[model samples]
Target: MGVVRAAGAQAAARLTARACRIAGRGATSLPGKVLLRLDPAAIGDLARRLPDGSIVISATNGKTTTAAMTAAILEADGRSAVHNRSGANMAGGIATTLLDARGDIGLLEVDEFWLDGVAAALKPRVTVLGNLFRDQLDRYGELEAIAQRWRVLAQSTVGQLVLNADDPAIAALGRGASSPIYFGVDDSRIGLDAAPHASDATHCGTCGTPFVYERRYLGHLGIYRCDVCATRRPAPSVVAQEVQLDGVSGSRFELVIDRTASIVELPLPGLYNVYNALGAAAAAHALGISMSTIVVGLEAVRPAFGRGESVAIAGRALKILLVKNPAGANEVLRTLSLEGGPLDLLAVLNDQIADGRDVSWIWDADFEGLAPTIGHATCAGTRAAEMALRLKYAGVAPSRITVCEDLPAALGAALDAGMGPLYAMPTYTAMLELRRELVRRGAAGDSFA
Candidate 1:
């Protein structure tokens, strides 16, 4: 009887989704919202019907890319997974994915705030926690609050746990889990000489003492030890050693898992992406996927939407790199700095509820590092003036900064002004707006949802 009701709700949701598409609206979260209202158990009932069970991936960042990498790996291994390809990752979005699934396994990237409830409902076979950083202080309170919730979820979940060993906060979560799998970077050549100003996890979560770092990778992710508590980063079983980063093009790294090594020529840039690949590889390893298959999957995985997505329009390349929080923005800026030339940028800053009403995080990002290289910057979105002001304070010349609150006008001006590749840095809502403009201009597909 329960299965019958769940099926009926799914059918109704599908009809609603079709109606939304016909009406020219995104059916990402609305249908699932309706389904859950009709049947609260729809998520679990539909998830359990999958033959190969489910895998849950969650973090403050990189969860979507990590899930996409895992999905690609599963595809390489000849397994089909029902995944949430779009960035919609809350309960309604996840339920919508389960409703539209045509595969044997469920692969999901959940929002950090929604991970507990979503994982509880899905009862995933493998749970991957990448890393935690300060994000959306208004919505998520503090990093410690989310960490506590994750610690509880880790303690209660009766499944395989895959964790990032370099993050002190994430590494500490493996305490009571049954043999958690740890993944991290072992390449000192790629490490930063000093920690960035936007580093989040500098203190040990266990002892409340400052962590002594041997090397700092992206933000607070690196090898560290606490002198007082004797707590240190776990020796990861799955590691990325001897990494080579190539500007904005891609990266190469030696992926070592359980004493076996394979060279992965990843088509993604930056050390943050290397961490994303490691998390995905570790999760796949936990699922018994072969090393060669994982490498193939990592090599073939494409960028998820605005995270390093590029489009060619009007004889110039427009690259979209999503920047929401400090850690994420810093990484994007760092990657742009690698291009080693003057850059043309379209920066959008929105204060939508999804983007957090507080727009103070831009102050923490390392925009100064790329200031000297910024040839021309057009600031757009709801807070265009503030973004332009930020660039000016970061050492960018006032003459080089253009303030245009409208996205379409700003995009046209930025493209016309640049002789080389143009970079677009936008927050969540702003990215959607920018993509919509791109789609209308026939540069991008309407299938972003």
Candidate 2:
């Protein structure tokens, strides 16, 4: 009877997927939603079908890109991974990926809030916890709450853990595990003198005392130590050293795996991407993949979805950078600041349920740094006026800021009105909408599973 139910759920999911494809809609989450509705245990059942066992990646940011990088690394070794590459990362999304399973290994990026449930069911062979940040407070509550949940997940898991040592919240989870692989940045040249104001997890996880930063990177991620408990950033076995970031084009860094080092020419911009690459390399190393293969695979990877993804429209290029919270936005803004020039930007802010609904995070981001670089700013989405106001306060003149509630019109104007490089910064839901509009205009390709 149980076998029959499982078969029935898979068949239903397949049918829905077929219909979705026929209807020209991308195969994303609706099929998995139906599958889970039919059989709640469908994820575990399908995950077990993989011969190489499963791997799960969870974080507030960079999970999708990290998962994509990992998949690329495995593919370099002639192995394939069934992944949630389109960024539908909930339970329904996981179920859909399994329903359409075609590879020996299952690589998934699970949502931060859904990590415990998904990990409990899949029991992945290698679980990667990158970092934790204050995101979507209306939905996920506090950062402490998510860290507590991750601690529980880490304790319960029997698999090997791969963690970011720079993040105290993530590093603390290793206390309960037998042996965890820790990865972090070691180069001081790329470090910030002080942490950003939007930085979360400043205090020590063990004690209530605040942490002292030796070298701060994006947000609270960097070298630091607790004066009270003496807890410090773990020396990462996998590290990116002597980093050099080039605007928009890419970044070059030496990927040091243990004592061996290889120069990595990553085609993605920003230091945040370097973190993603290191995490992916560490996870792949835990899975027995060689460092040489990891380096080759990482160099071959492109930006995932709206993350530093470039699209050609009207004979000009439009680069999309998805920013929802302060930390992520700061990194994007910092990257843009690296290219010294007048910039044309189309900023979209959405207050949908997926985007936290509370738009207070915009004020928390340090937009003042890039204010002088703005040539013209076209604000769009549900909270267009609010974004324009935020930019105004950040030092962008009122004459330079234009609010357009319509996304298509705003994008068109930004493209036609600009002479130099154009950038589109949008929240989660806004990215989807922008992509859909681009697809309708034949500017971008459809997303796949």
Candidate 3:
């Protein structure tokens, strides 16, 4: 943990990263792994060098996009950040980001499970806990377990806490915190008629009574209250009102902060993204960023990689929307439902470690809603047959679903079969493979690029 030893570890890690790049491999997390092996406290040591300190953002979904939005806001404010923009959020990724640091501050998107350790190390100026859903049940047990950890983090961290007031599990974390900045959507126009079957947080964390939702938004995120304990969604200082979701193009919402409002034109789709924008705005406000600057930054932000990233392949548009779990997948499907046409899809489902071995969560996702709109669907990845079967069960014609385990071949077939924009919905590893194939074909940039 000494200066000399930390310097030596960083040098070794840098050399390893150079070798990884030479060998045509991603250097995102490997070098950090090497650095940590040499110096276990390297993250803290390097993070301490940043004069402006760090900000940590974590959630089951939208952490990457939220962090990207916050990074854009920082850049608009003429500040530089050492950001893990490559969707790397674990200890290794955080260390690699610190190793390659050249900026005054750190903008880190941490994994939900790793938030505690990284927060302990970075002791960020602001810790943004976006909404958490049931993800990777094999690795991350239950939602309550992560919430308990976050509750501890909220209690122990000295930095300001930015929480989503709509999520009961997340809003409850602010109960003991001194002054948590809460953010949520104030628009009831976009709320679901009723909570979906995939909704995770149905009961109050305090009294174990079922929450009565006045209006349900994405998943369990909505305006809700508990009758037994009187626990309710916190009033958010940062709220998005009069929201307008513009399908795959993006969305617009009134960004309201402390009663003052500004129209924000966010170039990202879905109600889920609205939540992301609210969290980013709240976090930026907590850092003393002006409302005007926040609006400009939100407007300027782009899609974070596979999350709504569009690619041009052989003149046909292919939009990559990542679907990892039930809640996240439901949002993506809901967004797709907004587009006015029969959709062409390249749906890839992988049971990789990163994607979660239990692929049963696909059953919980409301694929039935989007089935009628499918023009032609190409299923690929380790679970291609299973994915195709799910689509068939969801009312997609069996003849319309083509099974191809190979990603490149499936992409080609999907392109050939579709006349319009093709939406590629892939799990974590499948998305990496799909992007790699696109990069190889000169259709897209590298993941880190």
- Per-prediction count of colliding residue pairs? 0, 0, 0
Candidate 2 lDDT score at position 130 = 90
Candidate number with the higher TM-score (2 or 3): 3
Residue-level lDDT tens digits of model 2 in 335-439: 999988699999999999999899999999999999999999999999999999999999999999989989999998888787867899999999999999999
Per-residue C-alpha lDDT of model 1 across residues 147-218, encoded as one tens digit per residue: 999989999853799999999899998997889999999986888877888788798887788999998898
Off by over 4 Å in 1: none
Candidate 3 weakest lDDT stretch, 10 residues: 149-158
Q: TM-scores across all candidates?
A: 0.98, 0.98, 0.98
Superposition TM-score, candidate 3 onto the true structure: 0.98
Estimate, for each residue in 1-449, the C-alpha lDDT of model 3 and write its tens digit. 67898889999999999999999898899999999999999898889888898999998999999999999999999999999999889999999989977998899999999999889988899999898899989989988899888888889863999999999989988998989999998986898976777888889888889999998889999999998888999899999999999999999999999999999899999999999999999989998999999998999999999999999988889999999999999999999999965999999999999999999999999999899999999999999999999999999999999999989999999999978899999999999999999999999987886
Candidate 3 residue runs with Cα over 4 Å from true position: none
Q: What C-alpha lDDT values do all the predictions have?
A: 0.91, 0.91, 0.92
Give candidate 3's error at residue 13 in angstroms: 1.6
lDDT over C-alpha atoms for residue 40 of model 1: 88
- Candidate 1 residue-wise lDDT at 10: 84
Clashing pairs in 1: none
